[model samples]
Target chain A: MTVSTLPAYPARSARLKRISAEYPHALGLLLLAPMLSWIAVFFIFPTAWMIWQSFSERGLQPYATILTSAIYLKVLLTTLKICVITTVGCLILGYPVAYVLTTARPSTRAVLLILVVLPYWLDFIVRSYSWMILLGRHGLINQLVTGLGISSTSLPLLYNLFSVSIGMIQILLPLTILTLFSTMVRIDRRLVDAATIHGASPWRAFRTVFLPLSLPGVYAACLLLFVSALGFYVTPALLGGPEQTMISQTIMVIASDLLDWPLASAAGVLLLVVTTSLLVLYSRFFRLDRMLGGMAR
Target chain B: MRAPRASLAVNGLAGAVLVFLLFPVLVVVLISFSSVDFLSFPPPSLSLRWYRTIFSNFEWINAFLLTLQVGALTALLSTLLGVPAAFALSRHVKRGQNVVNALVLAALVTPPIIKAISIYLYYVPFGLLNTVPGLAFAHTVSGIPFVVINVVAGLRGYDRDLERAASIHGASPLRAVLGITLPLIAPSIIVGAVFAFMQSAQELLIAMFVLGTLEKPLAVKLWEGVRVAIDPSLAAATTSVTVLAILGLVTVMLAGRRARPTRVAVQG
Candidate 1:
């Protein structure tokens, strides 16, 4: 009995060793299969099907319609215009906040960072609703204006490019600040001091030394904001007027209201092209991990 | 020896921007207690009537419950899927890692509107529209990125020697990971789960396409309400969401704090 058990122990140990040796490779594939399959089925396949549907029946007519029709062309241009506005608006409002975050004490920086990011957790519908309450005719802004005798009549603040820009900027400002702060915090302050010691003024030291280093962050933020802004659906839909209609809203209208799947798919494909190209350009310059890391924090 | 302080103008600008960011959400919270029916700031009188209404109204209550269910389901599914993929990406895969990474993160860059339309079309053929599970699955696509990103960041900072130590002590590889690795990364997993839940809760675009009139999430209900009317009830609904969001943010902050000491211990 003892001799038989001794031989079985060696066999069992060998089996364990073999399992350990071969496990990681097999395990990795097993681990990845679920998510990879889910994405392929739900995301990749659907996107491909949509693209195929675009040309399945009309055979380029939808593309021609988009190119030839005044409405589609105008909507595309308006979408671009709004995206540029949102990107610029976020930069102007967010840069100083990020700069201050980098310069502040750690406690103050933590508080400030929380303030910027807290809004990100709130729902877009709620944020957009808040904007409506503030910008409506008898809303908060008008109430303040009227109560203070600042204007005889309420300002048209609710449904325009200005309102859309404000709402979008507010929504995307946190992303801009976080991205900029992540990069700005990494710049060695001693470099600026080195420049100042070399006889440059304080502002000049920053301009020459720090600003160039921060450009990569600014470019990445703008690209991210611009691409994100291009996909504005809720904010623009809730805040903007007819003339301010974006391509996303146009697509929804086409798909749901007009019931034109092919036309909607064509427009979606067009939006996809522009966004993917910009992202490809971004990937060429900056690592996506850095951007995602900044966001996750 | 000290750096020059940020100028007064910069501080003031930043302060103003912070105020701009906080004021709207604050107004929504404040207006939810309005005594009157209409939406207004600095309400004539404060009351809990809207909150009571939200709790009592069937439509509002149903939507809120549905939103919570979907959020929970989405968080669970994404984590189960994302953690393994994150592990595979960070540890095991040697070849085609970049391709896999790109594939995983692709959902992050895809516009939500495009996702909504395409998924809506895809679901129609499969009869997946308007079901809670279907909605959760649709949301899981977006939720995967948050979980993967947070978990990967957590894993990057993790000390691999600890796992090897466990293995040397006669633990199987799987046992080492379950007992040693996962416990260390629990904070990240929590943060990821919270974000995924909040994202699914607040999501409206895909929900709008997938859900029908009979069953709606809070976001869709609020959206439909805002477009049609501006009332204290909408403010009440918005405030409830605001509270949930604040709670989620606090959880993440606490998770970050909890993660710090473990990291310090690992380094030391």
Candidate 2:
């Protein structure tokens, strides 16, 4: 790595410096200013306003209500429980798929990769609705279950936490696989071979040489999955019963339906705080740039 | 060689998961052909009634046309703004670029609801609430980052010495970039544009915040169809959207594959 601490603008050539120095990094700043301003105005400003609104009187009441009431608290707890289960489910299911993808030939790898990403092409609403049809009382699952003599009539498949988790796991599993697969590809194959030559079992070779190196992707995937799960609106709103309410759906109801911007803003602000904190924690333990950039292990 | 049975079991299990993954789409496709009014699986009889209904309905057509307009506009604007920004970020190792990079990541990471709410609040003062331009603007902001990320990945993998050599032969900086750099990075730029188009097509939360009752995107249309009507015709609309999205993706993949690598090649 080049570690030269040359200032961004170096006076290496006096004549060229004389011509450009007056601009004082002006070109780069000029290019960046518009996007920076756009984010500041549209992104940072709204978030700051949301936080401010959260402290106001109306927000405090809902904030008090959410924190004090058992119903809201129960929902919040259930959301977290589901997020953890989904994360673990993705890890279990995704690891082997990721491994197989990485070990495959390049052409095969490319096709498999595309297959994994293809489902995500559909709109989130469409995907959730597709699940709604599949998992409904008289839907495919119940029909198949009855055909196999597993149940008498259609089962109560919709309007439950099970449907919510199944939908999320489907949407999330591909991402986890891709992330972990990229990291695994960067690992040194010789290390595994070296373990094998030293008489380590196949499982031991992976455990000792592979898994530790792959932790960054696992952590990154979990972080992305958790934050994404927290922001979920459409899936739970469609598949979930009244009890499986997530914070995003709650925010929408409060802001749009209930005509309470402050309360909605408060919930949005809380969601942001919780998700951002999880990201910060992940970044602390893992080099997120490496995972996101899909670079070396 | 531990156990053939274990290997069979593992393959069998994976096959089951794959089936589960595909089961929903399969069900929807089947439901779309159902003859019954209420959604019944293993349709008593099959017909194209719902598909015919889709064309006859003004609401579906209007929402679809509006979505097409928004998607096209968002894709165009995102490419215009994002391509140059990605070029600048990738080519430079300037001071405080990391902070700028972090800002983009923050945009990517922030929840859609948060983004929608922010745009809503910001637009209220400018009377931009419930407007197409406002919704398009929100889509553009989010969409640009995808282009930037993809294009920058392309740039990072590029060899920079080729441009320096062209400049040494006395070519102008703009000519060197246009002739040398653009040719090499075309694939990534095309990929970025494709991603931006897909993002614009699927977005709903922004439309929820910015669109008025008069104009709604296809995703918003889908949402309402699920909540309000829950009709059999909704399946036909859903099927069409899926087909449209896949076709758009295939078109991009083909265009990217066909993009000439040397059309913009350097001349000395």
TM-score between model 2 and native? 0.87
TM-score of each: 0.90, 0.87
Q: Positional deviation of A87 in candidate 1, in angstroms?
A: 0.7
In model 1, how large is the Cα lDDT of residue A215? 88
Give me candidate 2's interface root-mean-square deviation: 5.1
> Top lDDT: which candidate number?
1
Off by over 4 Å in 2: A1-28, A56-62, A282-297, B1-16, B29-49, B94-98, B264-268
Model 2 alpha-carbon miss at residue B41, Å = 4.8
Could you report the Cα RMSD, in angstroms, for every candidate shown?
A: 5.0, 4.2
Chain B of candidate 2 achieves a TM-score of 0.81
Summarize candidate 2's per-residue lDDT along A1-297 as a digit string, tens digits.
011222232234334445445665654566566667766766787778767777776636867867887876776787788788788887887777777666668887787676676666667777788887778877778889998998888888898988888888887877787778767878988888898789887678778988998887887788878877877788889989987887777778878898777777777777787877776666555432333342111
TM-score of chain B of each: 0.86, 0.81
Please report the candidate that would top DockQ against the real structure.
Answer: 1
lDDT of 2 at B200: 73
